[model samples]
Target: MDIKQRNQNAIDLTFQNVTVTVQTKQGKKLLLQDVSGICKSSQITAILGSSGAGKTTLLNVLTNRIQNSKKVQVNGKIQANSTEINFRKFSEFGAYVMQDDVLLETMTVRECLQFAANLKVQGDQHEKDKVVQETLKILKLERCQNTLIGGQFVKKGISGGERKRTSIGFELVTNPSVIILDEPTSGLDSFTAYLLISELKRYAINKEKTVVFTIHSPSSDIWQLFDRVMLLIEGQFIYQGKGNQSILNYFSNQGFNCPRLQNPADYLMSIMHQNNKNAQNYPIYFQKYDSLLKPYVEKEIEQGEKFEILSYKFETSFVYQIQQIAKRSLNNVKRNPILFRARIIQAIIMGLIVGLIYFKSEGRSQVVFFKLIVQILIYLSKDGSNHPTSIRDMNDRNGLLFFVCINQLMMSLKPCSVSFPSMRKVFIREDNSKLYSPYAYFFGRLIIEIIPQIISPILYGLIQFYMVGLNDRTVGNVFFYFLCLILNSLLGLSLGYIGGSIFSDVKTAVFMSPLIFVPNALFGGFFKNRKNLASWIRWIEYLFPIKYSFNAIAANEYENTHFIPSPTELLNLEFSKWECVYILLGFIIGLLTISCFCLVCNRKRQQ
Candidate 1:
């Protein structure tokens, strides 16, 4: 294991004059200062330093994962196998594993790998199955093939090492020629960390793959496993070379003594921290590293004259991706009781509450708008003032009729917001791995998501439709109500999808979702008059699905009936019932389409 992994034809990754400057409120700051190095194939190059040493930043630059923003400046030339790196081509072959494990907890280990295989490997079911079996064996996860990944809520399954191995196996399924990881063993025990690194070393050697990772506080045994080591302090490389006694000697000669039996990893980290602390007075380590190691790096760059862009490779077709992802999404839903069943129960309870309030309210409509507005804004504000309603008119007919639509819309919004944010990390990990197109994942998820939206609303609608005594003409009304409910739910999901994809964390999505829905709910015709709204601001009515959905529900209940002398112009019930349905369908399709585009664009920029 002490010997450097090597294969003559393995890819050689070289970078020179790499500088990354990012903008901040105060000014532009250099995160990586002219860093340069070579990570030859069949070798494990570990970047080590104290926190904020720009170790991860360096990895991002080499892998072309750095965010290209107008506020950020990147200056560097990176060559792979003698040709300069081409982002489109490099993205096809290069695999990156983040510092945290991003996995679907509802799925079992084998199921997870199989789905990844189906997404990444272009072949029949047998071929995909073979890849899954081989990956399970290679990662030594055969025993836990059926064990769930588990989570904070579900029954626990597997261990820390197994989870990390699963993450690595995700990239390995694509058979990548180059693998980059950020702190792969951050939370594992020392022995487990040693084993994981050992397995990585084997991947590099046997598969002829280049391996690079950012690590913190690796054990002494783990330190010896890396083929090369790069040390950083304050965004500058302090050392980059073989991990051996020579490296220890390099620092020892610089007045930083390594105590007997001291772990080299810890010793290097301590010295780098000290150097960063006293850089103004003490001799800088980067100056010595540059002066001594310039020749080696320069020679490597000179020798890499055959670099060429690695063409983008997607094994599976877009249709295949959609099919496989759809199946996987359905499978995940089937396995998780909370994901699939809890929503129905929630919908039932909501139905009961609304039904009791509006029970047999077809003869009375004044309380309708007031109750619908109250339900919509309940999650937004603590006080009644947040939702101004008029219960003064007993003739405010069809107000309760419109509650069905507003109730479903608000209900659907939570599930959409809750579910998408939860799955965003998992989607990003698999999607970026080149497993499938963004459309495949998006549509597949939308399809599976519509299942709950369809079922939950049916239950709520049936219960409320009967309990509230809309039973006289319930047949036609129920069918249209159900369709509108599904569409409105999807609209909610799309809004949530946008917030979930745009924000990195679920907490942020949760905080922002309600605020976002405020405009939709207020302009939905239940809370205020749309026609009275200013001309410029009135356009927002077309943007939110709530407006169309409420209109459709009101039209279904009021048209040809003496429910009111004449429907309020603000209700805008000019259209027929079928027209309302078409409008709702339009909103559903449009919102999801926009959401998917924004997410795809966001992911592209992020990459």
Candidate 2:
């Protein structure tokens, strides 16, 4: 269906006898208690409440967003067009704009709407673009259409008001039957909030779409924009009726009058405060609401025509989902180059220092000091063919190779640890909107992250290869060495991806890296010979990526060796060079699969 057809499917939403309770240590605590209300099509309904008044809880219950388990119970019947509906059916007709704006900071306002259109709007490219343009005009965001959504780190783009409007436009592109926002006016100045509310009221009237939102601290002008108002206190309704003089009259008849020249919203909020003397009269107000208003609302809720709940089908293909996700990720990478630039600089500096430290030590004793004369003589005389590989030389070579493996692993791992956790909220919000599947997101992000993982290792390998005098200095050997380094880096990156997917906090992910890496390094056959460890524990070495990577590089280095002591035999590594390479590839795939599994688990937890 096109935008007009979808908008014409406007629905009247009703929730009845909704109660939410959480099992606490002491007892079950109620968040919302037997609340019932009807939000009609083509009207703006406002849920007003003070802090801890359960306004958001009621909204969540109506939208079927609250997670229900044994510890948390939700008992409610939500209807769309008077037909009982489940969460999936409700989500098909409704779009929720969250309190915090979750736009991709690198994307412009127009691009943000276009992305939603690509995923949600039914049509081809031209049709989706038309919807996006229409949404831009409707939201009055045409002037800043090309401006970025900007976050804490990115360069400034739009103002907070524009960002909020862009967020609204994102949902509007789908032309949903019902739109609900949680605290849309939050964090905006008085004038900006007034303008936003005016736009919302106009949109509701023009489109005939049901609009519902929770608000706090609305000025008198903002309050007057609502077609219907529902006042909540301590999880129960104190008032639910028309927003004009009728509400003032109802409260006045109860001996709580709005003073002249005072904002009605302010006066109402003051009385709703739990600590106010007016709060002691809440019982009387509740009795009056139950005696007078409950019957009328229940009757209105029962009048809607039955509607068939059609399942929502995604408009975009899987490949197109990946394509769009990757495009957004690339835009983010281009704008936020600080991390990538730092990784490059870190590789260059570390490679230079490490290569110089191990410079041409193949034939020399491990005790070679930095004396000028001796160093000059060694530089002139250093040749692989001059001296056979001694046990000491084998030990030194193993040391350098092990160091390279650890360096690539840590360099790749540290940065990726924070990547997924930082974007968790954005992913969850978009996932709830049904933009794409977890598999699409996983592969799309991996496609972009692999580029840097490849580039950094190649740079480090080129710098350290010839300088360390590894494996006869032949092109074939250099290629193999570089290949091993790149694979190790990717394996490290996969581990990092797994770590980030598992944790929701950056600090926790970083702190746990050493705890994971240190044990793996110990069993990697460098610190302790695997032959001497207990057989049960020795199997653990096969599980870590480090063992295979170090083994592969050392095997490649010592392939045609002329040493008296064979390093491979001395180290007791039984895997052939190619076998280790295959194992490294397996580990990379396995780790990535585990990361995707973790991402799926995270999604389930969010639901």
Candidate 3:
């Protein structure tokens, strides 16, 4: 399509006097200095620069991805179709593909695009599916459509080129008015890079969309595909004009002719890189661009017409977002069955081990003690009965109860802490893309986590409860014991979520977890009596979920016992079993609320 025949969605992206500086100890280090350019519809613009030359910085600045802050300052006029706009307004018409391909590794190429469409495409199921298939075809991902986008730690699937194209397809499925990418061909082979840029060019022309990306050293074949080019040295633009020989001609005009058979792109890069010898040349080239080349861009910007700007909006409903996120999570769980199966198997094996080691020791001890009492009574009269011990010794019963509480808690905690932080990048990427809100993602993850939290506790309780021989085997007691374990597991998961959400690094989250959890475990009433703790510090027991859980299970085991010294009084638990249950529920809710707050705050900080 030609410029005039461009679709209504077509819009030119232009930025002038754009300067970005970061506050360092040295003060006001320039990242981009007065960069100016325009990316017109139906054309592809490539920003060329060496490492740390501010090509990506200029892209982020023009796209308004960089904001003024205590450490950073940005000054610029970014216009869409010549109308100045803010970031939020610009988001309505622009989509940015990050340099790193932050994709859900568990998903296949088709499924990934489908998931994006469900959250980003505005239509019914049929329309969303159609968009996904079209995107697959456009990005040439159909051959690997069903192959999982695996990672280094997981099973490897697609090649580097395919993965890169998949990342671009994520933004392309939306058919945005202006598509901007950072280092789109950074990790690809020469032929693959050529294919990627060629597809981008065809897509830009066919769809009448403005396309811009940053590249370091593109192959000569790849360089020929650019309709426009902007080269930067340090933070200033040295050239801003047409690509191909036009760039060579401009440099040759400045007394630097291309060597025969040598790549012109490489030739220009060598000139820019020769800092010690040509340190003075950067200013000259920039000055030439300002005096000779910039006025034409300025005239084009002045004469450009305005197009209608659309308001920023999400494509799907909040409920739909939660559904799609949950569905994808469930699918991931199905594909990666090792983790899920390991959790259940761990619970079963640990339950067997704990049960066998302490197998009915409490029951057997009470049975022996009572039989002696019966023999003594028989010397005076007569008595006998066949029954396993039912809560006579406070130490054995209380010990089992405490172990169960801590067991459930740790089992739930470690996995959530390690796994959640690992997915933080993917979550942040999707969140920033506006695919879904933090609340939706949090709830979706909660749904997946809750299933195991419930199932594992049930299996653990069923295996260990009767085998260890607690107070009474009544249905109420059994259900209450199971309930406490479940709540404790959920509590542990909540704390895990908090740690994972607060820290972006998995190792850091896991390392710091013990510092937070071990202190609270000391207040669980088994390690030290809550009443014996200092008056000032005794209140910590009330804040700890494990304390309430341990107390509740202990009270359940000791309630109808015929023990001499009351275990509940000895343990210094002021709350009843039901009261502790209620408190644990409150703790679970409160901890999860903190997790949500931390997650939301982290996202804001990233922005």
Candidate 4:
């Protein structure tokens, strides 16, 4: 079948004298040393090397993934289609498939491609569907179209090869001219690996796509598929030429002979330019390669690349992009059973626990003697919170009401923080691919995930509020309570996102989460009276959302109500009910803004 489609803007990529120096504890280290090569159009070029070969680094540099840090120095000139181009501008015309399969595990194979299609394929639904269907057929993913992408330790889904193919299918939907992949065949069986590479080869030739990828080890069949091969050792290229007999002759003359039965790929991998510290032989290898392999690429290298950057355009509207992202995110939530149902179950269990524990607000009958004993204890305690308690029983009931606020806020934090890190990479990868604006993803993700932010707390709060039998049992009061929970949940979700986006890994987030929340808990006004808190430390109470949530929930339930101990036995309620609500809502808005900034920072760090 003719799988090729028109509008594949062919580009010739050439990098000249590219060098990378990274700052390390030991000192400055050369990651890539004067690497230069040309990957031509409509050809399969394989970057072959063992570990520490600078294969992935070079690919990253081309795609603008390299960090522009003072500690990391990059010196090189890259040209696309013969015109000197910087990474950012060059990236628009290319599609990069990262080494890891970063697809959403819960999404089906077809759904995954369709989502990519929606973001990338600038067309109506019919055209987008056509692109997705054709991509599936071309990539040979039709068999696993309905299978899930699956994660490492979780739900089972498509095979490793299919996952890799789906990753490729994502790029194909956009119909990019230049396609680059890092270790496309890694972790696949020989047969599957061969099939995958063969399909890539088909794309390169038939579709007029510039294909380049790094591979650690290639089976003989896979090796034969490469139109050109660049062999790298340490950080320098040792060979650059056609992938045929010329390679055997070039290596054979360099004191390395391939045995008749030995695999050619293995033989090629064995020829290292330099192996040990004593015999630094890179200069020698460079000289030999110049005499032997340089001539082959000299003509290709001399051809100046002229880039028609205008050929690449974003066809989809921003609103359409947001819609696509929201749809896919919603679909992911639906597909993941843990996210869909288990969380609702968790909310119910949590609600039941809170309700059963604080089932009723009961008071003790003792008056004068008990009050005198409490006064003696308060006088004796050095850290006595100075606020006068409400009717002792009313104060106890208010404490329970405040617990509801604290519990809801705490519950909201883990969901966003725990899930954000896992999903951050996927978001970054998609954004990097230029699928949509970063702003689109920021809003789209918020829109889709906000449902749970609304649902979990309301469900938990509703059960707890009715069961515990607080002062405000009216529908209006319950509505305000529910609104408070929603705001608190959003606050927690935003805080979690902040932590997740700020930290690179889950462990750092997990370790640091407690240190932050512990303070918020301490100053949250449930444990210490806000008025009695040390003046300097009181600022922290304002900074944390729990204080506002507590104040709001407390004021709502306690204000204008008669109780056993008469509302302020000890705690002071200075802020009006509406004022507290406004403060908490303001905190939610502030948190969301900060979270968005952190997310943008995370995206920047990724670049």
lDDT of the candidates, in the order given: 0.73, 0.82, 0.80, 0.75
Off by over 4 Å in 2: 1-8, 309-312, 364-388, 604-607
Model 4 per-residue lDDT tens digits across residues 1-607: 2223232366788888889999999999998988778998889899987788788899988776786687998888777876776555655688889898788887888988888778767768899899999999998999999987888535688888888989989887788888999999898999999998898888888877889999988998887888999988778778897896768777778766788788788876765623674136566767887776666566678873454544566647878878887887787777664664666787889988887776643532112222433433443321212122355555666667677666666676766676667777888778787778877887787898888878888788766754665543344555677788888778777777778778867788767777657777787777888778888877767777677777777766655545445454345666766787888778777777887787777775233
Q: Local error of candidate 1 at 391, Å? A: 14
lDDT by residue for model 2 (1-607), tens = 7755554476888899999999999998998889898998789999998898998788777777887898999998888877887666766778888888888888889999998899888878899999999889888899999988888778788998899999989888887778999889888899889988888888888877889999999988998899999999888998998997889999999898999889999999988888858677889979999998999888888875455534556557889889988988888889888888888888888888887887777564232223423433444322344233677777777888898898899998988988888888888877877778888998888898888989999888766655666664344555788899899889879999989999878899898888767877888899999989998777888778799888898888877666766677888878988999888888899999999999888874222
Best-matching candidate per TM-score: 2
The TM-scores of all predictions, comma-separated, are 0.84, 0.93, 0.93, 0.88
Higher-scoring candidate on lDDT, 1 or 3: 3
Q: Give the TM-score of candidate 3.
A: 0.93
TM-score of the candidate numbered 2? 0.93
How many clashing residue pairs appear in each of the predictions shown?
8, 0, 1, 16
Q: Which has the better lDDT: candidate 2, or candidate 4?
A: 2
Over 4 Å off in model 1, which ranges?
1-9, 249-260, 275-284, 305-312, 360-397, 471-478, 498-504, 514-545, 562-572, 604-607
Candidate 1 per-residue lDDT over residues 61-165, each given as its tens digit = 877777567888889887777677755556676788878888888788888888877776767889989988888888889998898998776568778888888
